[model samples]
Target: MHSSLNDHMTLLKEIAEFLNEETEMETMLQGALKKLLTRSVFASGWIFFIDGKGKHKLIAAENLPPALMENDCRSMKRGGCWCVSRYHNGELQKASNIIECQRIEQARRQSEKSSGEITHHATVPLQSGKEKFGLLNVATPNTIEYDQSELALLESIAFQIGSAIKRIHLTRQEQEIALVQERNRLARDLHDSVNQLLFSVTLTSRGAMEMTEDMELRDAFHDIHQLTQEALTEMRALIWQLRPKGLETGLLEGIKGYAEMLGIHVVTHVSGVIQLPSRIEETIFRIVQEGLNNIRKHAGTNQAELFLTVNSTDVLVILKDDGRGFHAGKIPGTLASVGMQSMRERAQAVEGTIEWISAPSEGTEVFVRIPY
Candidate 1:
């Protein structure tokens, strides 16, 4: 009995340390579940994170038999099982024996043999205080029941997981708040100092050009005025990127405003209503910004076309320009020096794909597809 208690204590200590060190939500959950199964009697374990809505996501899973593992764990990813239904209805409150695994039962019905050699499992509601997150499930091959001591151990581990989740969430919120504050501060400083100086220079240069009578002096003033105007436009675009002030209104309008600031005449055709998550919206906006900047600098064209198509599965964005397109082989050194690589990286960050299509004198087209 003493040895068993010591083992449980050791397991709990290890789990607590692991959870405390992990700041990423998915990593923490997956690692905790793996550790729990390796140290305990459970042969397999999985975590389900269900929101206020009935939608469920399989966050982590381990050591699944062929039936459950088939078709990319299709059975686990879909349908509401008994425990999830109970969770939605406020009935599952603590660690208890779930009479039968609904997923396994369904798999068994379709298979000739037992699915995972398992029929029942134990589930504990992962919660902190009055707030509930989801469920943690564990099972052994052919296990049908769990004793009070086992249920109590599961509950303790569940509590640790829940607390860790809350801590990670709160930390992320604080970091995001700090980041926004910093961005806004920088935007204000740039607007007040550099932005104003560029505007003043533009006005002074234009006035000097108008006042001058000598051709050479007038030409010099004209060049200064044009340079200052371009500088102001670039500064405004940078400020907009830093703060993204009008993104709350709509992403298309935000993109248009950024393009206009860069002195590009953009004609946009949007197929569907533009509603996207903030991260997606930001990624798309940055890509579009980069595309327009390229059109302004290298494409040798002041006009561009943007086509956006939103469907149930994915979003498609096409930016096209009828400008002096360069040789395809030479584009690596040309566009890569600009923000082409940065645009690709941004698209990859959102699990999307980006491609460039261009040829000499034919023009350039940027294609981006992202699934939500």
Candidate 2:
């Protein structure tokens, strides 16, 4: 009993962690149902989420028979081992023996078999405010009894999941609003900054050409014009970074450019066909740039290698420098450094990842991966 209780506590803790981390309702519910199965409490469980059209869809399930997983939720009949009907029309429901629950009379009637038994199920109606969100159903051979502690844990998970879903929905809305505002702000700033500065420099150069008789001064004016153009280029890059979802530039262009850089000899080997979204392209380029620059600035190694390979469903980008590598744990979290934090955030935003493979004598390596 002691061991079992400890295991149960651990499961609840894990459930709480998952609820806290999961922002999407479908994902949270799906994860909760699965976590519950980790213990012997519920032999099997599945979650059905109501869709926008008021249709109940079994979006996720745990401990489902392998055969049933491939098919639609509606296909499962009363004999199904574990199924949760996310029906919000009712309140907290507990059926010791699903076979005894008269609620599934239709399933009994539909089956012309020797035994007309409804599976034992315990369902807790999930609700957020007045609206019914979904159902969490677990099925077992016998009356699956849950005490106050168990029910409380499940209810707590339900509440946490509900809150997370709510928070995510609000966050999504706020982000959308912020994006619109940011777009307008960037537009205004672009006009006031880069465009104006470039236009003034161009006109000034023209005026100087027409009025100045000294060739040396004219040359100097041309130099100023060149420098202003370079600044304009940087401005364009900044704007590009601000709105990086533009995948049109392609990863090929970025890699080729990196190869041309003098200090960072990014020996690259790319094969097959690969494509990425604009956000991904920009992130890879920046990560590569930062990694190489770090090596140049910190690592005393003279060599670096960059490799790219594309496969169905995902793309991989690797950049490594054969210089002294520092311990990843020892690294400080400060923007004052280089691009470490930016690289991490960018990878996470796309559901991708980066690994820093360097320690002491080992060279530094930055790896990036993203779903295609």
Candidate 3:
């Protein structure tokens, strides 16, 4: 009994240390799973997290059955086993022995083609307070019942994992709010100070030009007026990019406003449902901004078109322009030219794809598809 108590204490300490590390959600889950599998009696384990769309996402798993891992675990994702359904329905409040998993049974029936087997398992819902994040399932080869102490230990581990996840989520939300606040403050300062000052300078220069009789003096005033106007235009664009006011309405409207600021005529079309996750919305906005900037600086065209199509699972965006396009093959292979590469990285961060099609003297098209 003393040995068992010492073992449990050691495991708890390890878990506490792991949770304190600042890491991403996936890495934290994977680390927790590995620690549990090594310290507990379970032969294998997996974690299923429910996303905002109420879909079960298998975030981390270790020593999983060969059959389940086959074809990238399509069966688990598509069908969803009994444990996941029970947890989602609020029926699984604690660790309990599952006589058999239907998923494993199905695989066993086709055992001639698969590689691994498990007869029974235990599942515990990972919850913090009243919120349920997901479930943790551990499997064993034989149908062995767990004692009270063993079940209690599993429940404790699940609770710790859930609390860690909640804490990380709250931290991220706070950071985002702080960032937005700072951006808005900067935008306000620029509009009230620098932007107004430039406008006044432009007016003063024009008045001076009209009053001057000397041709050279008039020319100097004209140049000052033009320079002030250009600076004001650039400042406005920067402020809009920092904090887009139209974004409160929708992404499309925000992009339209930005394009107008850049002196580009943008025709936009939307089809299907226009809902998107916040991260996806931000990524799309950045991509559009970059696309329009490229058109103004390099494309030398005044007209562009944007198309957005949304469905239950993904959002597609296409931005096209009839401008003096460059050779796509000539894309610089360095981070110094961050136009195309930055867009591609943003798309990839959301598990999405981006394509660029362009040719000299023709036109350019940027296609992006993101799955939520």
Q: Could you tell me every candidate's TM-score relative to the true structure?
A: 0.76, 0.42, 0.82
Candidate 3 worst ten-residue window by lDDT: 331-340
Candidates 1 and 2 compared: the better one by TM-score is: 1
Q: Which candidate tops TM-score?
A: 3
Write the candidate numbers in order of decreasing TM-score: 3, 1, 2
Model 2: lDDT to the true structure: 0.62
Q: Write the per-residue lDDT of candidate 1 for residues 65-146, one digit (tens) a residue.
A: 7788777888899987999989988999999898898998887776664476888889998988888889999989978998
Predictions in order: lDDT: 0.87, 0.62, 0.85
Superposition TM-score, candidate 1 onto the true structure:
0.76
Per-residue alpha-carbon lDDT of candidate 2 for residues 94-136, written as tens digits (9 for 90 to 100) = 3223333332333444444322122446555555665555556
TM-score for predicted model 3 compared with the true structure? 0.82
Top-scoring candidate (lDDT): 1
Q: Mind giving the per-residue lDDT tens digits that candidate 3 earns over 340-370? A: 8888898999989998888888889999999
Q: What are the runs in model 3 whose C-alpha is more than 4 Å off?
A: 1-6, 21-23, 63-80, 85-91, 98-120, 141-148, 192-228, 332-337
